[model samples]
Target: MNEADFAALRGAILALPYVRMLGFDIAREDGVLRGQLPFAERLIGNPLVPALHGGVVAALLHFTAAAQVMREARMARLPRVFTCTIEYLASPDLRDSYASASIVTRTRRFANVRVSAWQPHSGKTIAAATMQFLTGQMD
Candidate 1:
């Protein structure tokens, strides 16, 4: 997509209520997306106990994967997650976490993306995910 088209699509993603509610700020340029996971209390954990919800981590991975597909496809519509698997290397503490999602593969109707979440202090991968997205026809 052209500059104007990409900008419009990015703006549309920023407008989503759920995206805004989750405090996800996703930005893309030159076929790469950088996203920040909000350091909300909901994401922290006790390590010995279940501090981070698996669903929350999955949601973050889903968003990251979708953004990667959108940048690569350069389409107006956001891609949908059809399937995904995540591996938790370690639980993330309360500090800020950053992630980068990249396209692993793409087919006519779908895309495979990999997303890794890291904590700045430890520089360790807290979680890794692979997601498949359904790329429907774009208007």
Candidate 2:
């Protein structure tokens, strides 16, 4: 994606209230769309285990997927989420976590994306999701 497109995407994401509350920092690096969720006290779901909230991980996956579709497909506007299915593989520690997304399929009006969230490595992914988005545009 070009600089301008990435900037627009960043702006759109930052505009979201929930995203802002979650402190999601998004960027493109080495041709990959990445989202980083900083560790915050409010994000701890299990105080006993001191693990990051599962919802937080799911939200990051969703956001990462949308950003990927918007940046890669160059959609004129933000795509509407049709469905998101997430699988939790492990509990995330109380630390910064990251997510990355890939477009599985793209047509005129819909896109299928696969997203993975991990703290340190892909092999230790905390969660994985497949999302379908309504692009609201024709190719």
Candidate 3:
């Protein structure tokens, strides 16, 4: 990510319609892309457990992985996600959630990324995902 435009990336992420609907706050700082999903009634899955919807967590993982792959691979456009395997370690509570992603394997036209999510002060992972994408480029 040499000479990366952190502001532009962040702005692009924030400008996404889904990100806005989910009230996600994302920042690319110090070479890390940190994401926060603020608590909202619409995002709750179960009132008894007071957990966030699994789909929401998946979205965080999916988008995070794609973003990382796009930036690290330096693709002209975001790699199209073809496969994503999500593992729910634990139910995220009804509060702000966070996530980060890293590239696992990247080749000329393929990429894989790993993503982990958690809550502040939880000290335990809530979920994780492995995403595969088509980069459509040859190095």
Candidate 4:
């Protein structure tokens, strides 16, 4: 994608209400899309474990996959999430978390994406997700 297209995608991502509420910041590195979820008190679901909420992590993974599809496919509109399955590998600590997505397959009508999330280190996965999104013709 061109620089202008990338900038527009970034703007759209940050403009999403839930992404903004979660303080998610997105960036691209060497053609790869990455996202960060800043540490927030509201994200803590289990007070006993004090771990980041599963929903929050799942949201991050979903958003990451959607953003990847939008950027890589150069789609003008965000695709509809058809289905998603997330696996929690480890409890995330009270710290910033990062996620990256890989587009596994893309057809005219649908795209499949795999996402991995980690805190502190990318080598260690906290959660993983496979998502399928309904795609439209690229503009």
RMSD of each: 3.2, 2.2, 2.4, 2.5
- Model 4 scores what on Cα lDDT? 0.88
Please give the CA lDDT of all the candidate structures. Answer: 0.74, 0.88, 0.80, 0.88
lDDT of 4 by residue, 1-139 (tens): 6788888998888888988999988788887789889999999989899899999999889888888999877776668999898999998988899999999999988899999999875457999999999886445
Provide the lDDT at 106 for model 3: 83
lDDT of 3 by residue, 1-139 (tens): 5445655565666677898899987666787877778889999878788789999999888777777776776654446887888999997888788889988888877888889999877888999998889887445
Q: Candidate 3 — which pairs collide?
A: none
Ranking by lDDT: 4, 2, 3, 1
Model 1 lDDT per residue over 3-122, tens place: 676677668677778777767777655656777767777564455674565666666677777767877887666787788889988877666666788888888888888898877898
- Name the regions of candidate 4 deviating beyond 4 angstroms: 121-123, 137-139
Write model 2 residue lDDT over 59-112, tens digit each, in one string: 889888888898877765568999888999998988889999999999888999
Candidate number that wins on lDDT, 1 or 2: 2
TM-score of 3: 0.87
Q: Which stretches of candidate 1 lie over 4 Å from their true place?
A: 1-6, 28-31, 44-50, 137-139
Clashing pairs in 4: none
Per-model TM against the reference: 0.81, 0.92, 0.87, 0.92
